[model samples]
Target: MRESLKVQPHHLERDAYLYIRQSSMRQVVENVESTKRQYALRGRATALGWRDEQIIVVDNDQGESGASAAWREGFQRLVSDVGMGRAGIVMGLEVSRLARNNADWQRLLEICALADTLILDEDGVYDPTSFNDRLLLGLKGTMSEAELHVIKARLRGGILNKVRRGEYRCTLPTGLIYDQSGNVRLDPDTQVSETIAHFFDTFSRVGSACQTVKAFRKDGLLFPSRLRNSQTTVFRPLTASTANAS
Candidate 1:
């Protein structure tokens, strides 16, 4: 008869990071306790013979709205730090903390996979080198993409509802005005808008954005995206004339 042996858990050492984020104030209050509990991931690292310096933690407080990628400042830095090879692993309270949007979420996951970064959750560790983990990551990214679609749908519905109510759903076009009832109306005095429209029409007929730009320069017109002097003229493209040439 063949003898069976119990397998010992794998023992290895690697740097790790703990990234935490909250979607709203509710998670802030309710999750802080759980958030502190996130330190237990450090214990996991410790068991692997990794020390404290090899680990990092990043968390966002009172973070809600989950829509803006710019909201998580520390999280973004942590990602950068990890990318620089300062650390070799990343952990989060869960997948949602990593990203609320598919783009950012998938980006972090891809970095981890490519960098051979291990991901840990309360259930267990995820080794990116594993074939099954890569496949599971793909599935999770797809699910996150679906989540992104739902969020965009809700935002579109809300904006459309506001528009249907005859309410201003967003700011006036640049150079327009908000009247007393908060309706946006064109400012008759700002000839800039008509100038811009004419420029676009002329450009379409001219067939080159660059040639149209030259025409604007000849006529002392300016692009809104371009910088302007106190007097403001596109003919003197400030960036071009002032900045060192590439």
Candidate 2:
């Protein structure tokens, strides 16, 4: 009854914009239920008096992060439509789905307020033009941003714990490999081991990275570089950057 009062005929006359998003491709693939729940909001729009054709599902943002609106084309389109008074109601499964950033969320709320557009989540219908609804929406946006921060903090803490315990496995640099037993060991290839030893020997003698690179170039020595994605090593002319990194 209260939801019906907030959604006016004027709102129903315009299109209902249903914005859908997931933070990562992993979520889009593994979290099938969540995606289905978001798409099911089309039925919610129908219940709010929007026809099938009048409901626009903006799902281009799938597998994209909500930390910012800079790279989200779907979010930009929704904001543009709302600002142009084309969207009668903007719907999402939750505020976090719409935007996890306070700036992006508040901007959307402001535009919806000015356009007299409604915001619909699983909770209830909210009229952004109404002061009370606007405040509640603001709080939800803030909470969404806070929620993201908390998740990141927890993940960082777990990674740091793993690092302290020497359990964190990082990519091995060139001339090093993780053996079958997952122990760090030198490359089995004698050429790779010899090249790395010679480079260091030159570096120690030259006492300068730039001079070491020049020495390799002058000696016409090709450095053995291991490809990141494969165990194969390729010999290439060593640049200052590569020498410095080594």
Candidate 3:
């Protein structure tokens, strides 16, 4: 089998770290091909002369965002291992999979450069120690970050445009909901509507959320709570926080 010249004997002697991540749980569930492609990098690592047992997969951050490394345990561990000379090369589907934040990406590159560790992606292997490779990697990181920013900006613009046209569909409060025509209206349920009206009236009289909750408890009244991902509403004992939120 042909091997990359960058994969030296010393590099093959060390473990290969395969870092896998997806931006969100929804993407993790729906973007199966991307995840598979990332896992398939193990084959690439083996082809490069690293043994299967020596390829370490750091996937704890699978459903976590790449925006920052502070909250990603897998990324933190990968960086720590690379810094400690435990990793010969770091493998990812791409630079964006590793990190979207330039600071985070740069930190990892610096650590890898210092440790003489190589980085591999679908494009090719990159040696952070080499000036050309490092420059290219830095550009990739910047573009990844810019891509995220552009996506957010586009989404924000679309939402703003919808709002300007009074067409933005947002979740309503407990006492209101979208009708069949997508217009916001008071809940049709008499009990729910009356209860919410009473809550507001009580709050106005009591002048405190805790007192309103106390009054509801005293009257043995239940507050309507909409269950997540379901159209059904449930009535339960009210708390000060819920009353205040309403």
Candidate 4:
């Protein structure tokens, strides 16, 4: 509840948009509390004198990254409504939920300012038309963008360091596994190991991936592949393209 947010009669005549978003699908699935908190903003709008119909929840962007607005249909809709003078207030958990990219955030700031729309977050309500509020929001957007960069840099650096130490654990290719002690080796399954060895031997003799694939097809052989994020191994038809890539 900000002093500047007086809820004028004209504001009551317009719609209130509740924007809900999470940076990734993993977060959307794991961060239940954050999703609940974002959805709770609809109650905030209602408390601010908006009827149920007057409040719009833009949650289609949920589980999508706020890093860019290009693919965000919900965010695009919100912006279109605000630009068309339909939005009285735009509420979210925070500015970062609305946008992590400064370009998108600044564009939103400009639209809200021009349309005289109010913005509400966990901190408080703000009028983007107000110089102080707009400045503060711009700073927050910059900080969010910088935060994304810092996080990516840290992750990349960590992965690189692990790689240099021969300790990086990426998704294992077919017929390979890491032991309890983190040493890379052929899969423990003898049949799988033998099949892989046969494939390589055949490929060496053929001197062409296309010929290897033909040989496998002629022999009715299947390639072993591990399913993602699982311990299950499956067999699949190996094509010429797949053989070349492997």
On lDDT, the leading prediction is 2
lDDT tens digits by residue: candidate 1, 4-97? 0110122134456777666766677777787676666787666655568766667653364445467667767866875765556677766656
Greater-lDDT candidate between 1 and 3: 3
Q: If scored against the real structure, what TM-score would every candidate get? A: 0.51, 0.75, 0.79, 0.74
Tens digits of lDDT, candidate 2, 35-102: 99999999988987899999999999999999999999999999999999999999999999999999
User: Could you tell me the lDDT of residue 238 within candidate 2?
Assistant: 90
Off by over 4 Å in 3: 1-3, 181-183, 186-246
Tell me, by TM-score, which candidate is best.
3
Q: Is candidate 3 or candidate 4 better by lDDT?
A: 3
Show the lowest summed lDDT stretch of 10 residues, model 1. Answer: 1-10
RMSD of each: 9.4, 5.8, 3.9, 4.7
Tens-digit lDDT track of model 4 for 1-246: 553456777888999999988888889899999999998888778888889999888899978888899999999999999999999999989888999899999999999989989988988888887888888888988998999889889999999999999888898888888889998888989878888898999999999999999999999999887898876889888887779878
> For each predicted model, how many residue pairs clash, with residues at least 3 apart or on different chains?
2, 0, 0, 0
Q: Rate the local accuracy (lDDT) of all candidates.
A: 0.60, 0.93, 0.92, 0.89
